[model samples]
Every structure is written in C-alpha cells, then in structure tokens.
Target: MWNLPYVFPMKRVMLMDIKVLIVEDDPMVAEINKKFTEAVKGFLVVGQARNGMEAMAQIPVKQPDLVILDIYMPQCDGMEVLQEIRKQDRPVDIIMITAADDTVTVSKALRQGVVAYITKPFKFERYKAVLEGYRHFKQTIMQKENLGQEEIDGLLPVRMTREERDMPKNIQAQTLQRISQYLLEQAQSFSAEEVAAGVGMSRVTSRRYLEYMAEQGLAERELYYIAVGRPIHRFRLVRQPEK
Candidate 1:
C-alpha cells in the first residue's frame, strides 16, 4: 500500500507588523516609548511626534494603525489632536497615554473614542498587556468582516458606565493596572511603600491600589511586623482556580 502525502491548506496568518505612532511632548519619554514598542512582538514604531501640531501632521504621513498620545503638550494637546483626527475623519485607533486623571478629561476622552487610556508611570507589563490586547482586537477585526452580537461584544466590549468601571472613587484604574503588573512579576509579598518605590508613586497611592486589589481578591493582604510597635501590611497576587 502506498501512502500519499496530504498537505492541508494552512490558515494564512498576516505577518505584517502593526505600524504605530508615538506622540508625546517629552523627548526622553518618546524615546522610552519607542524602545518599549520595539520590544513588543508584532508592533513597529513608524514615527514619533513631539507636539500636538507635529502629531497632526505625522498622522497623515505615518498613517499608523494606532497612536499613543499624551494629553498635555505645546501648540495642541492630545485631546485636540484626537479632535483634529476625528474632524478630518481619520480611521486610526488611539490609546491615550497621559498623566491627567481628572474625571472631566477622562470622560471627554471616553466620549471622543479612545481604544484605551493609560496613565503615565506605568509598568512594561501593563504596556505589554495593552499592545497584546490590541493585537487580539486587530486580528478579530481583520478576520471578521461582519460580526454578530457576541462577536461584536468580544471585539469591542459593551461599554459600562464610569461608575461601574470606577467602583471605588479616589482609585485610578491605571494605577491599579500598574499594581497588577507588579503582582504578576513578584512572587514574594510586598508592602505598599515598596510598591510605591517600585512603581514611582506615593505610598498612599500605592496602598490605595493594593487595598483595592485586596478588596477584589486580585491580591492577598496580610499584617506583619518586624521590630516595630505597629503591624505592617503586606500583599501578594492571589492564585485563581483553573477552568
């Protein structure tokens, strides 16, 4: 008996890198973002812009799949850039990367249509998660020409009100994400002060995020003491049960 070789038609994968634009007023920050984007697997940093005016000009020339935008800048700000892009009917996705967390600004950005908003002083893991999520989203968008309700929901999740997303006031979602990233990398328990130093934020800010995670069961919190009158609080990531 002779066996014939069967070569099934493989599912084609588009290997082309997703082009991206870095739009931040800070030169050093832009450089860091460039390096970070380059380090990611399927992304290519196509161009960099230092100001909103520059970003406006480069958006056309670069024609990026995505733009990482900073909210504050000279000449024009990120919000302005986003407005201009919409005004011109550009189809590029945007992720707001800024230091501003005021509700007014955040609400404005959400209304104006940002794929995501990340605060400054975020971890590499957080950045990586954003890009990876976008990668999944892009693939879904490409593969599905017409999406059903479930598919649409999977691609662009149903929008929850700001209250739902921000359950506990005084806690920034971005900061919580940074803390989650820290937990992912650390096996040893840590203090809020240590998280503050590690993530370049204040102890109070770090504790807020840590405590919030504890409330959500994303992290475990315990009290410990070392030659002190008062007990110290420590935290570690919680292990989730397998499906």
Candidate 2:
C-alpha cells in the first residue's frame, strides 16, 4: 500500500451573500428576473415588488444589497421609486431594466445613481454576464484597502471610447451622435434607410455609421424580410457587457 503525503490548505474567507430586491410591474418578467438572480451563486432574492409604492414599502424592510428596477410602472414610475430610495438615504446599488432605450432616460437614470442599465429582450447569457460583472466589481471594492479615482471608475460599466465617440474618416461627429442617440432611444431595430429618414442623414452616410457600430460591437445586424426582393438589414445596439 502506498501512502500519499498530507498537505495543509489555506482557509478561504467566504463573503456574505448579496441580498437583492426586484421592482417590476410585469409578473412574468419579474419572475424570470428573480429566477436569474437566484441562479447566480452569491445572490439571494430578498423580496419582489410590482410597483414603486410596493418597492418603497419592502425595500426598507428587506434592506437589500441591490435593486433591479423597471422604469415603467402603473402606480409609480421607477424615477419616483429611485427618488424615494434616495430620500431615505439608502445606499443600495441599483440596476435599471427598461424597454425604453432613449438617451435622455438613460442619462437620467445614471444621474440618479443607477449602477447599470439593461434594455429589455436581452439574452439570458447577457443577463448572466452583467450579473457576473457586478459580482466581480463588488468583490473588488470589498477587498480593496485604498482605491484611487481611476480604480473607483474602473468598477463602472465600460462606456463608448473616445475614438468610438468620434466619427470615422469622412463622417461628422454631430451626425453620428444624433443617429446613435436615436437608436439608443428606440425599442426596435431600424434600417439604415429608416434611420437616415429619421435623423435627416443620407442613407449612404447612415449605413457607414451603422456598419462602424457593428464593427465596434456596439451594434448588431439582422435581416428583415418584407415581401423582399432582397432582405433588408437592420441594426440594434448590443447591450451586453464588453468582454
């Protein structure tokens, strides 16, 4: 009989699980999000709310570590709930889930201290990715002794780069920003021709910007058929976190 050498192992410190509160109007969507939260290893669903009022009632009781909020609700909107949360001086991290992709809406939510924004009709994998990113960010912050401004900024979601903000060779920045803003605002995808009409850009120029967005992984292309001789190609922003 052969004996194996014994080795001592280091004890790992277990971080406390994250408590989550979900505020959503749609029961089915809320359930789906709840399941996803439960599926993540270190996250726990503490409570669920169907509107802003319910959220206000339960959030203080639960004292959740995070809140997943929907913008549109009947009794009260997400902005109202957020304001209430702020008024109470709650420090819970917030992630906004909305079908409205408008730049103005997104800007408002961000200004209100939302940690992340996820558009609706997202893939499960993308949803998982965002959660994982949040988990990592949280862990990093917890483990840090001293953090600089840059280190703090690193915890947030990646935004469009300076080059991405700039227009490609011949395209104007103003034109590109307008088009990008429009796409970010809409629930559905748009063709280059449609976007051109909406933004008052030439179809050819709009196509260039769309193609650039696709190459940068900010947008994805899909085919649309409407009794078509050739299927029209449409573009939609890719909301998944960059790898």
Identify the leading candidate in terms of TM-score: 1
For 1-243, candidate 1 gives per-residue lDDT tens digits of: 113232222245564799999999899999999998889999999999999999898988989999999999999999999988888889899999999999999889988889888998999889988887787668657855776543354345464443544457786667777777877788677889888988899998888888876654456676665553556777887532111
TM-score of 1: 0.62
TM-score of each: 0.62, 0.61
Across 25-113, the per-residue lDDT of candidate 2 in tens digits comes to 99999999999888887999999999999999998799999999999999999988988888778989898999989999998888888
Tally clashing residue pairs in candidate 2.
3
User: What C-alpha lDDT values do all the predictions have?
Assistant: 0.78, 0.78
Once model 1 is optimally superposed onto the true structure by TM-score, how far is the C-alpha of residue 114 displaced, in angstroms? Answer: 0.5
